[model samples]
Target: WQAKKLCPELVLVPPRHDRYAEISRQVNALYMQYTDLVEPASIDESYLDVTGSLPHFGLSAHALGDQVRRRVREEIGITISVGISFCKAFAKMGSDLKKPDATTEITRENYRDILWPLPVGALLYAGKRTCEQLRMQGIHTVGDLARTDRQALAALLGRGGDALWLAANGLEDAPVVPPDEQPAVKSVGNGRTFPRDLVTYDEVRRALITLSDEVATRLREAHMMCRAVQVSIKDPKLKVIVRQMQVGRPTWQRREISDTALKVMAANWREGAPIRALTVTAENLIPADQATEQISLFDAVPQKQREKQEKLERAVLQLRKKYGADSILLGPGDEEH
Candidate 1:
């Protein structure tokens, strides 16, 4: 809000994702007035499948889209832009082109002309890191990439580079997969690249613990559990090592995840070498109810320790949630000096 005052053009507000989601549901409902086949991409974006309903709506797809946007502004107190397209990916891309809080459209014919010459950053899946790499290679525009050979790009940027090629050609095999089949909760992971190289095992372990707590809190927030865990590290020179482990049962239990993560860190870490980064990932997630558990003998901790850890974890979560993420103090930097 303060930033908006400094520059009037700056659209600023404390992001209330929950509030936006509520408004999104209402906007999606308005869209359903035009067609039932609506795919919500995010709180601020949705793709409407208006294939057969245009006839009864008494409006062309564009006209129906205009009405939907107007309805959201008039009825919900928030403005929305709609993009009518044959597929989800294009619909999103079309919406992005008009985004300063407005709506636009792109038919199959206009897609190539409209998207081809635009900067590579304009493409849907073009990531910040990828765009910088392209800029470094002197390929600033999508057209330059589209004209490049696939094999050469793959060699330069691996599979990600090839994906850029496909997107630049306006060629992608992705489907408008329904949200349910898309898996509501897919992954829980955290990675941090320290600004310096770290040489101490204890220091690296502290960073891993912090990341583990974050990953576990995220999983619990989504009411999900993981059956697999993985750990990765990068040396000062950027050499990478990774390890994956399967749990006997799925668990959202932060303690279990932390224990396994620490074990991996202990096993895979270079004994006394400087390292620059640490990453931990949990995959094969399922709802908490579906997770399995096991009886423990030597693995069990003392009740006093468990209670103390639980209190600390809950306090940290409360403080972090109320304040920004960096509000809490944790371990020293794990990067190589």
Candidate 2:
């Protein structure tokens, strides 16, 4: 409503899901021609590992990126931005630096010169809150973050901060997994941008509950249990921060997931901060059949109670699948925020 009010003549077009999926397939096919190590990041973005193919095609990494961009434009009538770098994270970062039929290359020798001066937020996965925390410590630029002690970063933002430090120093080594290989699922999560900013604890709690419920549902559907819960918060200004914590046990219960997400949010988020979006993710996943929960005599929640909740969640899932997603709603007292 705000956008339409600001621009009365603005046009709104509904998404064409089928058309987009078709185009995505064609683009992936084009990438396969260059290398089989094609990792589709999303319907519109992909990462191609052309190391082996570079020698085969007699082209440098940058040349291959340009060729792919040109082929995409000429064949599909769409322009793409390409980033060429030694590692997956840096390549992903480089791709975002340019747009619309451009290629940005970050070689090992030149990466520090090109990326070190940029803001810490420019690094992949460095959310808005993380940037603010880094700035608070007088670490302003990518170089500053890279130069900071890795142990300090880990203490500051957990493992994610450690990842940022690695990426800043160009030490990231994550590979672009091929589609046919079918890598194991590492995490299941959900997030949304609300229509309005959420200011109160109740509002944030409600949003977190919804997202956690969704994540739990997905985990259960896949026969998985997560030992950790991750939350990503995006403020009204479009800055984001991601944090996660161990749930103390591998579980697929919505109540547990929501509680852990709430804890994470409480630790990182300031009271009354206007949140534009919230995400809840289940991480450190293991197969439900394989997950062994150690029964603690000191456990606050009884094992029987936990089992009952799990049964209820499974029943709810069955109802949603048999009827419709909206056919049933969770009772108010199932869990507390």
Candidate 3:
């Protein structure tokens, strides 16, 4: 309502996440009919690596793209634009050149003429803010960005600018990830915005316990362990403060994650400060099977005890999986209010 007062033309539509996901799956299935190497970029976009299928289909890239567009229009009753190129970046760039039902091809011989004249902001990852910065530096076009020195761009916009310059020049060769493959897990995190502001240590501790339990569960599910824990505290005024600390041992245990998150929170946040939200993130992830703990000489818990605790946790996890998530509770205050 407040936004409409400022912008009278604003139109709002309720999000249909489930329906969009189903549509995406159906579209990806159509891509798989042509090639198994389909990478879904988002709900509305995807990249297809049809190098091997090209010979079998007896069609050029542009023809294959046309076939895909026709198939989608006829079967799905939705029109799709496509771009055909040797690389994912340029292919994506080509796709954006046209609208609802068009196919644009960017071959090695013609890409320079087709891509270089576009504004620098048209490049992937170069948003409005980045374009403004680049324009201030006299980089107004994609050609200008490509010709700029990589080191100079890095100095101006950090590594992202240098990477963008490389991309503009068609120097990037990142492979399109296949649909069935899982990319390496970087971090697992969970956060919540409280209904009421919390200003007590007990409230904060309870919140951290709940968050850590979720994070630890996700880590275990991914077969990964975290070597560091980070806590983000957002005050009632929307100011945010983050603190992180490396753990003594890499762990996926709920107790360890909770304790570490609490330690960082205590170190960085005022004891009774009003907090609107908090997030606990497990970082520096490694495969659980490959994780080796450095046993301290003065360690309190023995290896046998630690092993037993992990076994018990795994058992509880299985019970929850078989019965229901609410079938088991860790402690007295574990139930969500």
Candidate 4:
């Protein structure tokens, strides 16, 4: 409504994430041709370490930036802003300082002149809240933060303060990460906002089972298993509560994930409280082949039964894959009696 008032004629387009992902891949492929140390920051942003490529290309940093910018504009029809600096933090700051189709360079000789006078909020990782906190202490610019005592900054914001101080002084040394060296998946989960509130245990249980099934499928697809299960429950009034518990043994099965989530919900929720949304998450993941569980001497039979059930589930999965996702499903009567 406010947008319409601001512009009598305005056009809005829906986002196409898949199309953006394809373009990102094409651009990343181009970056790889220039340097092996290309890091994708987002769908439309990336950081390339051209230190090694400079000697091979025989071009200075600013020249390399211009070359890449020209290629991207000509080949991909996208204009990118480039930032050249000694470190990742300053590079990010430089990138943001310029507009589309421009290059900004921050060097040891000129960084103080170019960056120190900028507002504290201009520094990377310093959000509005952090900027306000710094202003409260009479630190309003990058220079002020650089001059502040390290111990005082540490006392104010812990280790984050140390990082900010390093960035302000152009001492940040973090390296750009490549795609293959990216961190492992830390968790897998699925969530849903129901069309209407669920007010009974059976309703919430059904939703949890559905979400758990999705999470378990993702875990299996990734060849991983979760050692913990977490659930987020939101009331009709929009109040939310999160609860988590260890699963005792690693699992990538919907039965276990759903059961764990149910236990969490039961311990925290009222019997007939209306639920607005639900999320089921599998956490502390590990390779499924590397997961192990200690067996109880007295419960050997149950362990064997579980192994047989797992085999049956795998068979069901194969059958579904051969036919369709909805080809086969477990029913209430399918439970082991």
Candidate 5:
């Protein structure tokens, strides 16, 4: 309401994710023209390692960046900021230094002069809490953080403090992974904010089933199974609580995910408490083919029954693919009831 009052002329627009993905593909194609070593960080950002292509393209790093920027604007009809540096972290920092259509280069010699004067919060992963902690210790600027004793900083902030100290001193060595060389699946999750607050176990149960179903579907699509399930609940006041539990075995079955999530919720959530949002996440993933389930001596659900369930779910997946996504529904209860 305050934003509307302050900017009465402001117009809101809904996001078109499909269209954005299409545009991202087009932009990435342009990046590939210069180097095969393109790493897409997000839908709108990418890092192009043009070191090998420098001789082939007959352009320096800065010059290559300018060319890429120009081609993106000309072909994709969107302006992009470019950053050229010896390392990935500093290059990302340089990109944030300007906006729209611009290029910034951070070299080994000049990084100290350019980056040290900036606020510590300007560094990546330095959030409000970290900033407050740093300020309390008289570490106000990036320089202050860089100059702080690494042992003392670690004592103050744990492992994260050591990482920040390294990043602050330009020792961050994380590589930019190309699209093809990206790491394996870590976790898959789905969440929803309801139109009305859910105040009953039944309501929460239905929501969890819906979220878990989607998460299971995604895991199967990726040919992965999760050994753990995590749930996040947000109340009407927007305070959030998260809980996770290890599964009996790694499984991508919707029933298993939903059941585990409900158990976690029962253990952590207060009964009849109003919740505005809920999320279900499948964690500690392993590839379905590589997953070796160890049968417990007192296991209730036998191996054969679990295999049959997997087959049934795959058949359902095929039916959903043939028809529309909403053609079938699983689970025992309906939200409308």
Candidate 6:
């Protein structure tokens, strides 16, 4: 994130889910070699039950946690933070405190010394509003909550207050369970800003054409199609005007995405709007096989244009495969601003 922030001219691309899943398969396979009680919590985090594996690993739990951190960084080009505890709640809390290639440990004996000193909002399920409420009643910190009257808190906050009291004491009732099913991808989109604010319709139209084309090309490459197209116009004033559409099916056709975007641009935008950024988003995706067809019998788009797009998609994929990503982008991909 900092790398992208420092180089503001560089396009900040979304993390590719396909590439992540491929890496996850390898990491989980390695985890199973250590313990079968591991559960993936999110794309970047997991929970492991290593109670029975201490003998095999020939190390204490803290040592094992260190090994796991090393394994993640060595196997994947990413860093991970971990927390180990006797129970799920505190273990998660420990991990939350540890970040960016680090690990932490907590147990019942030292729970108050560690957890109590932290802010109340640092508890796993606590929210900002709850902390503010607690502070309003002179409970400014986790230590303050531990010293507060539970009966009065429960009376004031009702069930919510009771839950907070228990959590603050690390005495929750629920257990850590595993996720049940596969996770699916959500939205896919691309955005670019002009070298300067583009004022003419022709300039805006050209920029929209390039962005829409890039998005449509990638959607088809994923073997996915979109059900909706959204256009965003970001201006010098930092105000944004967005126009949305719900199309019936996914389309690889540039005309389909482009035409919809033109309507959005014309309807939602002002005639002389000074623009700082433009983004094109395609959402509610489906498999290519299930995507709805939009081309009509009467609308005969040019044959050469279709050939060019297909060739461009293939070329980009092939380059990304053989060389590396960003080795080549569509030449003159940007519109004159």
User: Of the pair 4 and 5, which is ahead by TM-score?
Assistant: 5
> Candidate 4 deviates by what RMSD?
7.1
Structural similarity to truth (TM-score) of each candidate: 0.68, 0.64, 0.65, 0.67, 0.75, 0.56
lDDT (Cα, tens digit) per residue for candidate 4, span 1-337: 5676799798877565446767899999999999999999878888899888899999999998999999999999898899999998888889888888799999999999999999999888898768888999999999999999998998998899999999999888888999789788899989998878889877887788878877987798788999999999988777899999999699997788888998999899987788899999999999999998889898899788778868876876677566555566555532422
Give the lDDT of residue 77 in candidate 6.
Answer: 68
Question: Which pairs, if any, clash in model 5?
Answer: none
Ranking 5 against 6 by lDDT, winner: 5
Q: Which tens-of-lDDT digit does each residue in 1-337 have in candidate 6?
A: 5666789788877556557766777777777778877778766667778888899989999998899889879877677778888877678889988688788888888989998888878876567767777878988777788778899989978888887788777776554444443345466688997768988887788788778767876786677788888998889876888888876445665556877887888888876778999999888888888754556655456545656766766666676656544455433433111
Point out where model 3 deviates above 4 Å.
1-13, 179-183, 189-227, 231-242, 246-266, 269-280, 286-337
In candidate 1, what are the lDDT values of residues 1-337, reduced to their tens digit? 4566679898655555445556778887877777666667766777666767878877887877777777788898887666656555556677777755666777778877877788888777777877888888888888888888899889988998888788777676566544655658778899999867778877777877778777888887788889888988888777899897886667665566767887887777666888888888888899987755554676467545656665766676677667645566554542111
RMSD (CA, Å), candidate 2 to true, equals 7.4
RMSD of each: 6.4, 7.4, 6.6, 7.1, 5.3, 7.5
Error of 1 at 320 (Å): 12
Question: Which clashing pairs does model 1 show?
Answer: 196-335, 196-336, 197-335, 197-336, 197-337, 198-335, 198-336
Write one digit per residue (lDDT tens) for candidate 3, span 1-337. 6678899999988565546667788899999999888889988999998999999999998899999999999998889999988888899999999997999998889988999999998899998768989999999999999999999999999989888978888888988888469579899999999878999888899999989988988899899999999999998888898889998788998878998998998888777789999999999999999998677777647766778878877887787666556566556464322
Residue 118, model 5: lDDT of: 94
Model 2 misplaced stretches (Cα beyond 4 Å): 197-337
Give the lowest summed-lDDT range of ten residues in model 4.
328-337
